[model samples]
Target: MKKKDNVDLLLIEEMREEEPSWTDYDMDETSVKVQLTDTVFDMLLNDTISSLRRIETRLT
Candidate 1:
């Protein structure tokens, strides 16, 4: 795999590890909203990254 792919995998792994922390009930409403927003952003970013990789593969 390419270095970019490796970096992507690492980022994914990090995100997975942080997933459980978002479930903690001690956070305030604002914090929860921010975390949820970050989660949604990360999901969209990963989707975009996958799409770009697919396009790159098709072109090469």
Candidate 2:
């Protein structure tokens, strides 16, 4: 079989040899906690708003 352009044949063979663990298909029961202050929250909100506005202007 011919490999596609710039494709990694060795990596593909290695992956095919690997046996997938239960973690690959099963979801773990873990809780994540993030405590963001007002200042950090405002910065993230502003950045997201600006990115959306930029996209909207480009599309219009």
Candidate 3:
């Protein structure tokens, strides 16, 4: 994707609404998988992971 597209997605993620339940668990595979059963969890997880990737890319 283009750099602008990446920035747009990052902004979208940053503005996303999160579930209170998502904060109840560690950012791990098991927790994520269990939460995958819920759309809220899945979207939040994907947004979080995407943000992390963006951070890593900038750091490198």
Highest TM-score, which number?
1
* Tens digit of per-residue lDDT, candidate 1, span 12-46: 99999999898867668789899999999999999
Q: How far in Å is the alpha carbon of 23 misplaced in model 2? A: 47
Which candidate should be chosen as best, given lDDT against the real structure? 1
For model 3, give the 10-residue run with minimal summed lDDT: 17-26
State every prediction's TM-score relative to the real structure: 0.54, 0.40, 0.39
lDDT of 2 by residue, 1-60 (tens): 356632677777767777465346433332111234556788999999999999999999
* Model 3 TM-score (2 dp): 0.39
Question: Order of candidates by lDDT, top first?
Answer: 1, 3, 2
List ranges where model 3 is wrong by over 4 Å. 1-37
State model 1's lDDT: 0.94
In model 1, the clashing pairs are none
| Poorest lDDT segment (10 consecutive residues) of candidate 1 | 23-32
Indicate the worst ten consecutive residues by lDDT in candidate 2.
26-35
| Backbone atom clashes (below 3 Å) for every candidate | 0, 0, 0
* lDDT at position 39, candidate 1: 100
RMSD of 3: 25.1
2 versus 3: better TM-score goes to:
2
